[model samples]
Target: MSFVVAVDGPSGSGKSSTARGVADRLGFAYLDTGAMYRAVTWALLQRGVDTADAAAVAATVGEVRIDSGTDPLAPTIAADGIDVAGPIRSDEVVRHVSPVSAVPQVRTRLVDLQRRVIVGTDAPGIVVEGRDIGTVVATDAPLKVFLVADPQARAERRAAEEGGSDTAATAASLQRRDRIDSTRAASPLAKADDAVEIDSTHLSLDEVIGRIVSLVEERR
Candidate 1:
C-alpha cells in the first residue's frame, strides 16, 4: 500500500508550505485540498452563481472541472481547463471559499476526486493538506498531523504571505473562517483522534518541516 501523510490545520497554520516541504524532501506527491475548494469557489464567482444558495452552488459545482497537479516542487490547480492557481488566491475567492466548501454537495464531489488522486499517485507516498484531510479525506493515512499556531502567529504569517496585508484584518478573517469551518455540517475542521498535534506558533518553517519529516520517518 502507498504510504499517505495527512496534514490538517486551519488557515495560516503552515499546512501548505510545511506539507510541500515534506513532500519535496521525501519524494512524495503533494495535494493541496484547500486549493481544490478555492478553484470551485473561483468558478462560482466567475460564473456569477450565488454562493449563498446551496442548491445553485451544488448544481454549478458539478459543471466545473477542477484539476490539481501532485508535483510538490511546482504544484498547480486549474478550473474548467483554465489555469487558476493565481485567481483562486484572489481576495474574492478567499472570501467565498469557506461557504462554498461548506456545501455538502461540493464536499462530496471534491472528496471523491481527492481520493482518486491519492490512490493514483505514482510516488511511494503522498502528503495531503487541508482542514479535514485527517478526519475525512484520508482517514486511513499512516501519518496524520494536526498543525496549529496561535491566532497572532497565524495572522502575522498570513499577512506576510499576502504582501503585508493588514495583520488585524487578516486575523479577524481567519477567526471568521475558523468558526465556519469548525461548525459546518459537512466534515468539520477537527483533529482526528489519533493525530499528532504540532503547535507551530513559535517554530521556524524549517524547524516545523523537519519535525514532520522526522515523524514520517518514525512511522515508516
Candidate 2:
C-alpha cells in the first residue's frame, strides 16, 4: 500500500526541503516532481524543439528518460542517460520550464512518469513535491500540504540559493515564473480545498519539518 504525501507550493517556498525531511524521517521515497519537468524542458531545448509547438514537444518527448533519488542532496536528474544535473537548472531551462510545464500534453506525460516512479517500488510511501501535486497528479494522497510564504521572503530564499547570482536578476526571474505558474490554465499552482495550508515565512527549517512530521504521525 502506497501512502503519498502531496506537497504543493510556489517557488522558493519550503515544500521541497520540507517534503524531503518528512520522507527521510519516515523512510519514504522522495520525488522532486518539479525537477522531472525541468529535465524535460532542458531536453527539449537541447533538441531545439520549439517551446510553443505542442506537436514538436509530443514528438521528441519519448526520447527523454529521467530518474530521481530520494536523497535530496544526491538527487539525480538525467535525460537520455546524460546527467543533466547542471543544464537542467540553467537560466534558459528555468525560463522555459513554466511554458513547457503548462502544456497539457507535457503534464500528461510527466504525470504518468511520476506516478510510475512513486509506485514502482515496494516502498511504503512517497513524499512528492511540486507545484500541483495535491490538486492534479496526486490528489488522492493521504496527506496534502500547501506551503506559502510572502513573495519577498520567497524571493530572498531563492536569491541565497543561487550562490552569488545577482539578487535582483534571480528575483525577477522567480517573479516571472510565479506569474506564469499562477496564470496557467492547466493545474496551476493552487491550494486544494482539503489541503493543510502552511505559512512558512517565519518558521525555522526544523520547525516546519517537525510540524509536518507531527501532522503525519498523528494522522497515521
Candidate 3:
C-alpha cells in the first residue's frame, strides 16, 4: 500500500525539515509544494508582472513552468527552466509570494500539478509539505501532520535560517503572511480535520521527525 504523508504548516514551523527527515527515514519521496509556489512568485517577478494585479499574475500561469525535485536529500526547484531554489528564498520573493499564491488561478494550476506529482511518484509514498497539504492537496493522505510554533519561536527559527536576519521584522512579516494566507479565498491555509497537530515550539528537529516517523510506522 502506498503510504502518503501530508504535512501542513505555516512558515518556520519546521514543515520542510520534518517532512524531509521523515521521508529520508522512511525512504519515501519528499515534495515541497511551497517551493512550487515560490517558483511561480519568482517567475512573476522575473517577468515584471504586477503582483497586485491578480488578473495579470494569473495570466502568466501558462508561461511559467515550475519543476520540483522530490529527493529528500537534495530537493530542488526551477522556474521557467532556470534554477531558482536560491533566488526564490530572497526577501523580495518572500514579500510577494503570499499575494501571488492567493490568486485563485495560480492555486488551481499548482494544486493540480502537486496532485499529479503525488500520484505519479514511483517511491513507496511521498511526504508532501505545504500550507494546505493536509487540507487540500492530499486530504486522503494516510498520515497527516499539522505543525505549529509560537510566533516568537517561528520568527527566531526563520531568522536563524536566513543568516542573522532581524527577528522582530521576521516575526511581523510572518504574522502578516499568516493573516494573508489564512484568509485567502483559494485553498487558504488550514489544518485538515483528521490531521494530527504538533506544537513544535519546544521540540528539536529530530524529535519532531521522530514523532512523525513513529506515526507513520503505526499506520503501516
Clashes found in each candidate (C-alpha, N, C closer than 3 A): 0, 0, 0
Highest-lDDT candidate = 1
What digit string (tens of lDDT, one per residue) describes model 1 on residues 126-205? 99999888899999999999999999999999999999999999999999999999999999999999999999999998
Can you give the TM-score per candidate against the true fold?
A: 0.99, 0.94, 0.98
Measured by TM-score, how close is model 2 to the native structure?
0.94
Q: Between candidates 1 and 2, which one is better according to TM-score?
A: 1
RMSD of each candidate relative to the true structure: 0.6, 1.5, 0.8
Write model 2 residue lDDT over 1-220, tens digit each, in one string.
5788888998989787888888888877888989899999998998899988877887777777777766644577788778888888787888888888888878888889888877784668788999888998888888898998887788888878777677678678878888889999887988988899989999988888888888888777
Q: Lowest-lDDT window of 10 residues in candidate 2?
A: 66-75
Residue 134 displacement in candidate 1 (angstroms): 0.8
Collision pairs in model 1 = none
* Root-mean-square deviation of candidate 2: 1.5
**Candidate 2 stretches greater than 4 Å from native:** none
Note the Cα lDDT for every prediction shown. 0.95, 0.84, 0.92
